[model samples]
Target: MQNSDSDFFGRQGDEKILYVVRPHPLATTAALIKIYIISLAIFFVLVVLGSQIRVVSSIFYVGLQQIPEHLPGMR
Candidate 1:
């Protein structure tokens, strides 16, 4: 026979409500703002750096040089 006095999910005797820990509202807000500002600053820096650079890859050039013969200019 199932005990009617037992808590749901079968926990027995210690039927006390669990105390949940919660952070202060002001502190959480301040932390989120700080993170957002730091990320914005980093994003701007990367954008500025990307604008001042041109990326080139030599891999395609090397691959073209290695093409097999009897394929016209590859001879």
Candidate 2:
């Protein structure tokens, strides 16, 4: 596979070097599937992390709000 990319295969079909991720589009289908799978996993992980952060922050805020109740002079 030469790096010149004269008649590269594209996602649509054979194209003339418009853009070349790979020299042959034969691997495009598998590559796209892999990319989708990886992205989905990352998305789910991020969602879970965000929810956990929200829960923790809410608990911290609630603790702060209850501090005045424990103070003798502030009551």
Best by lDDT, which number?
1
Worst 10 residues of 1 by lDDT: 1-10
Q: What is the C-alpha lDDT of each candidate?
A: 0.70, 0.63
> Can you write out model 2's per-residue Cα lDDT over 1-75, one digit (the tens) per residue?
333446432334554455545356758888899999999999999999887763334654666656455545432
Q: What value does the lDDT take at residue 58 in candidate 2?
A: 60
**lDDT tens readout by residue for model 1, 1-75:** 453433345565767646545688999999999999999999999999998875545763666656456555423
lDDT of 2 at 5: 41
Model 2 worst lDDT run, 10 consecutive residues:
2-11
For TM-score, the strongest prediction is 1
Shift in Å, residue 71, candidate 1: 26
